[model samples]
Target: MASLWSKISAVLPLNEERFPLQFGDRVESSVVEMLKRSRRQLYSDSPSASRTLNAQVILDISWERLNTGTWRHVDKEWRRVYSYGCLFKVAALCRENPSEDEILQAVRTCDMSFLMGAAIMENILQDVVQILQSEIRKSAKDEDDSEHAEVKRIKIASPHVPVIKDQLAVPRIKCPSLESFNTNYLLPLKPVILEGIIDHWPALNKHSWSIEYLRTVAGCRTVPVEVGSRYTDEDWSQTLLTVNEFIDRYILCKDGGKCPGYLAQHQLFDQIPELKEDIRLPDYCCLGEGDEDDITVNAWFGPGGTVSPLHQDPQQNFLAQVVGSKYIRLYSPEDSDKLYPHQSPLLHNTSQVEVENPDAERFPEFAEAPYLECLLRPGDVLFIPVRHWHYVRSLELSFSVSFWWS
Candidate 1:
C-alpha cells in the first residue's frame, strides 16, 4: 500500500526539475479559494432547493511542485520560468487481487487525488498570469500597454458563468405533473431494476431476471422517462437485456478510470464487500427519518438506456459509473421549470417534453434551459445536486453506482 503521494510520485517523476523549492509554494490556497467562490455561486442554500459542494476532499499536488527554477530550463540556458500546472487522471490503482497492504496504503491516505489535480491545474494558470505580468512590466511603455490589454482580454475571456438569475431563465418550467415521489425525498436512489442491477454480480451475472424467478423484478417499475417519443415495448426490453451484457463486459476488463461511460478511479468492489456476495442482488435501504427515503438506484442495459429525464436528485448524489458510457445533459436547479419534473412525489413522471425536440409551441419555456453536457465513461463519477435537473443517455451498455445519502 502506498500513500496517494507515493502512487502519484510512482507515475510522475518528481525532483528539483519538478519541485525546486525545498518546500513548494502552497498553490492549494489559491485553488481552494477559487473553487469555494465558484461553488458558492452555483449553490445557495434555499428551502425549496438546496445545492452544495459536499465532496470537499480532493487530491492536492500543488505543494509538491511550484518554483521558478523547476521549469526554468527551456533552451540551453536556465531562465526563471515559473510554470505551475495540475494534472487530472482517474484510475483504479489497486483492484482484483489487491493485497491488504495495497488497500491499507490507499485507505490510509485520504483520497484527495481529484481535488489535488484540480488545484495543481489552477496553480499553473496563476503562474502563467504572473509570468505575463512580469514580462509586460519589463517591456517598453507602448509594448507593455498592448501586452497588458491582450492579457486582460485573455483573462476575462476565461469561462465565467452568468448570474444565477440569468441562468435560471434558460429552462422553461411547464405542465407540472400531478404526482411525484414526495418532497421529503426529492431525488432518485438505487432502485435496482432487480433485473439489471445484479446482472454483473459475479454470482448473478447470468442469473435469471425473469419475472417468475425474482418477484422483485416484476414489482419494480420503470418510471416513465418520456411520454411522446416512446420506445416500443419490444425495443425497451431489448435495451435492458443489452445493458446487462455491456456492464458485465465493462467490469470484466478492469480498466478503472474515466472512460467513455464512467469517472476516474471509481472502483466499488474494494469498498463494498457485500457486492461480492454469492447471491448478487441489490438490497433497498433508506438513509433518512421515518418511512420516507430520498435515495434510490436503477440499473440499466444497452445503448439507448438513460437515467430519468433531467431532474434533480432529492438529496446530493455522486453517480459513479461502474460500467459503460453515459452522456449527461445538465441544467441548474433554476432551470427546473424548463425540465418540467413532476411536482408530486407519488408519481415518478416528468413532463413528456422530448429532450431532442424543443417545441416551444407546447413547452415554450424550455427554450431557456442553459445546459452543460458531458459523457461519463466507466470509472468516472458525476456529481449531481438537489434540484439540479439533468438527463442521462447511454452511449453503450452501462451500469452505475449511485451514492445518495443526506
Candidate 2:
C-alpha cells in the first residue's frame, strides 16, 4: 500500500506552486473567487500532498452546466478549470491506502479529455491499471494456494442477423498507392472496400484483443456509452460507465431484447493510450486537406443489435473493423430527399426513414433511393466519401475504429 501510494504521488505534479488558480482573464469575478476558495488548506511538505485545488468548486459548476444543458457551449476557461479539478481530485483520493474498488471509483467519477489534460489522464490511467492488475493477479494466485486458477470464459456473439439486401455491393480493391487511390476513388468521390490493408495492426495479430485481455488492460477506465437500441429513439441517452461494468452487463451477457449499450463515436484514444497503440493510422488520410492532427479517430464498441441510423458525415471516413462484422448500407447525398431526412436542426444529418424498417406511409419515396452495401469484417476498411449517407449495424460483439479526415 505504501508503494502504491508512492507510485501515484510520483505521477502527479505535486506542489508546483500553481495552487489557488486564478483565471482572471475573461472569467467573471464571482467565479474567480470560487476558484481561490477551492485551494488546498494545508501546505504539506510531503511530495504526496493533496492536488484537490478547485476540484470541489469547479465540479459543482460543471455539474450545474450539465443540469442546465449548457455543458456543450461552456467557456474554454471553465473546461480548463474542470480538467485540473478532476485530475487533482484523483491524486488526492489515491493518496491514502485505497483499495482496488476505491481506486476504480475514483477514476470512474472523474471525467477525462475535457480539453487541457488529455495526455496527462492517459499516462495516469496506464499507471493505475498496471498497478492494480499486478496487485489483482498476486491476490488471485494467493487465493488459489499459489496455483494458477483457470478463469471461466464466456462465448460472445450476436443473436440477431445483421445482413440487409440492397442493390449493389461496394467495390473491393487491394490497398493502392496514395496517388493511385486519390486518382481513382477519392477523385470520383466513390465508396470502396480496401482489403489487405491494416493487416499489420497489432490489434489484428500480436496482442490480439480478447474479452479477458480487454478487461485486464482497460476494464476500470470510464467512457461514455450510448444506451439504447438506436440513437433515434426517445429513450436514447448517454451515460458514463466503467469498461468493466459495460463488459459485464453488455458483452458477457446475452442480449435481453431491451436497449443495447454502445460506446460510439468517442475519442477514446485521447484517454487510454495503451489501446491506441494497437492500431495504426491509414496512409490514405493524408490525401485529405489537413495535417495529421486534423484527423479524427473514434472508437465504436458494442454488442449486437446496436444500430447507427442513416446519416452523413462532413468528412471522408474510413471505418476499420477490428473484432467483428458490420452490415452497412450507403446512399449518395443527391438522394437525401428520397431518404426523408429529419426536419429538426439537431437531426438534419440523420434520416427519418429507418433503412431496414421504413415506414411505408410516411416515407414512400425512400424505397426509390439507390444504395450500395457491404459486410465489413476484420481487416476490412470501408471508405465513405464526405456527405455519403450510411446506416450501420453490428453483427456481433464488435469493436471498430473509424478515422475521419477533411
Candidate 3:
C-alpha cells in the first residue's frame, strides 16, 4: 500500500507550476505574491518556524471574510485564499516529519471547502480523509469478527416510532426504469417513494453505518450544527462542533430543557470524502432537466423531533434515508398562496405557516391546502419536485443524504 505522502507529495509542485502568481484576479496581487513566497519557503527546511505563521494570519483573515456577512454559495477569490492557507499548513506539517496524528488534526481542524474545482487542494483533503477512514475501519475489526458485518444494528436513540398515516400519500414504486421514471415522475413533476433502490449501497452492507462507526471515523472532524429546534425559531442559531461533541450533546441528550441540535443542510461529503465513498449518487439525479453543475448533495443528520419548518427548495430533490426514519409532508406549487411564505429575501423560500400545527386564526388559507405525506424509512428515497412546499421532522436519531438537482 502506498503512503498518503508518497501518493500526494508531488501534487503541490504541480499546482505551483500550474498557478504561478495569478495577479489579475479579484484577490490582490500582494496576496498572490504572499502565496508564491509561502510556497517557496515550503521548500526550505524551517518552513513551519516562520512561513507557516504568516500563512496562518492570511488564512484567518480570508476565513473570516468567507464565513461572516452575507453567505454566498460561491466566492471564487476568497476560497482560493482559504485553499492556499490549508495547502501551506499541510505542506509545512508534512515537511517537518510530523506524525499521522498531526496531519489528521490539521485536516480536521481546517474548513474542507476549499477552492471549487481545484483538484490540487482536493488531492490534499482526499488523501488525509481516506487514510483516516481506513484507519477507523481497521479499528472496528473486533466488532465485525462474529457477525460478518462491520457494524451491528445498535439501538437508536428514539423509541419505536409509529409511521405517519395519510389519506393523500406519496406514490411508492420499486426501482422503476429510467425511461418510465422520467415519464411518470420527472416529466409529470410528481413525488414518489422509490423502493428497492439504494438497497445495495456498501454503506448499508459492507460498512454498515451506525453511531459508533461514524464517531470512530469522524468524531474529531468539526461540522456546523444548528443549535436550536428549527431554523425558523427566534432562538435558532448555528455553532461549530466536532462529531463526537455533537453526538454526546445532541443525539443522546436526555434533558428536556436543552434545545435540539441538528447537523442539517451541510455538504458533509465534500468535507469527509470518506463518507462519499459509502454511498452512491442515484442515477435518477441525472434525470433532472438542469445543467449537471446544478446538482448539490448534502447530509442531514440529527436527533428525533428536529424539524424543517415548511420550506421549499429551488431544485428537485431526492431525499434518501440512511438510518432511522422521518415524516415528510409536501404540497404542490399551486398551494404557494396557502403556505404563507416569509417575505424576507433570506428566508423567502421558507413558509411562515407551520405544516403540522398551523395557526388557524392567523393563517386561515394554510388549513385548506391539501398535501401528500410519507414516512421515509432506511433504504428508501423520496422524490420532491422543485418548488414543492415540504416540511420534515426526524422520527428518530437519523442520518439522511439529499441530492438536489434543478
Candidate 4:
C-alpha cells in the first residue's frame, strides 16, 4: 500500500549522500575502471587491493586502469556499468522535474536489484537510453542556421518526385461484368479502375450526402476524426467529435491555413445502419474465400490537401470515390527495398521517403522505383492488391468508401 514515490525511493534511494550524482566521460570512465579493478581484486585476492576496493576507491579511480579485457571480463563489466549508470541517471532525472507518472512507471517496471546481471541490466539500459534520447531531441533546435549576414547562402534544395519512364499503368474499364472482373483482375493480382461501377449508390447523388443531409442523418453520432494535414506529421492527433462539429470545422470552414480534419477508416455503416443502404459490396470481393460479412467497409471523408502517406494493407481493397476526386500513386511490391520504409515500429509499413516531395540525397534509390499514378473521380473504384504500396491525396473535398476483403 506504499505510494509511488515511496516505491521509487525504496528501489532507488533518494539520499544525495548515498548516490552522488555525476555524468559525462569522467563518471563513465570511473565506473568502468571500478568494475575492472573489482574483477582483478576478485581473482588476485590481494589484501591491500581488497581494502582499497571501497566506495571511495571506486569513485576516485583513474581511466588508465580501464583497459580492454577478454569477453568474459568485458561482459561482467558491461552489466555492472549499465546497472550502476542507470541508477544514477534515474536519480538525476527525478531531480530534473519529471512527472509523477513517469516516476511511477519506472518504479513499477524496473528491476531495482544492484545484483541484476547483464541481461536485466541491458534491458534497463535500453529503456533509460530511449528516455534520455527523447529528452535530448526535444531540447534540440529544429534549424541550425546562423543569424549573421556575412554571406548569403542557398537553402537545402527541396525534394522532387521523379516520373517513372515505364510505369505500369493500372487498367481502367467501364462497368465490367462481375465474372470478367474476378477472372481478369482478382485472380491475376492486377490492379484495375472500375468506372461507372458505383453509379447506383445513393451517396453519388448530391442531395443524399450533402453537408446538410449528413448533419441531419448522423449529426449527434460521435466519430473519431483525425485532426491534422497528414498522420506522418508530429502534430497529428485523433479526437472524438459529432458529425455536425466535423462538418462545421472542416467541411464548411474556408480557412486555408488550418489543418484538415478527416474521418477515415471508420465503420460508419455499423455505427449508423442508415448509411449501409448508401453503398453495395461488389461481387468481385466474393471471388476470394470469405463470406460477404467478412468484408470491412470503411469511410474516408476529408477536405483537399489531406494526405494518406505511402503504406500497404493486408487485404485487397476497393477504394470507391463517392464525391469529389483524389490523386493516387502506387508502387509495386518488388520495389519495396527501394522505397526506404520507416524503421520505427509505429510506422514500419509506411515509407520514410515522401512521394510528392522526395529527398533524392537521402533516398537515392527511390528515383529508380517505378510507380503508377492516377486521378480518381466520382463513381470510380480503384482496386488495390494486398501489400501494394499506395499514397493518396485529396484533389478536392472528397468522400470515399473503401471495401477490404481477403
By lDDT, the best candidate is 3
Candidate 4 deviant stretches above 4 angstroms: 1-169
What does each candidate score in C-alpha RMSD?
25.9, 4.3, 4.2, 18.0
- Tens-place lDDT per residue, model 2, 234-259, is 99998877787887677655445364
- Write model 4 residue lDDT over 139-193, tens digit each, in one string: 4343223411211111121222334334465678988887888889887777889
Listed in order, each prediction's TM-score against the native is: 0.32, 0.85, 0.84, 0.58
- True lDDT of residue 68, candidate 4: 43
- Estimate candidate 4's RMSD in Å: 18.0
Model 3: per-residue lDDT, tens digit, 254-306? 57527599997556777776688899888887776776567788899887888
Q: Candidate 1 overall Cα lDDT vs. reference?
A: 0.36
Whose TM-score is greatest here? Answer: 2
- Candidate 1: tens digits of C-alpha lDDT, residues 160-219: 222334332222212222132222123442111112333344433443322221212211
As for candidate 3, its clashing pairs are: none
By summed lDDT, the worst window of 10 consecutive residues in model 3 runs over: 147-156
Stretches of candidate 1 off by over 4 Å are 1-298, 305-307, 342-349
- Tally clashes: model 2: 0
Q: Kindly indicate the candidate among 1 and 2 with the higher lDDT.
A: 2
The total number of steric clashes, by the backbone 3 Å criterion, in model 3 comes to: 0
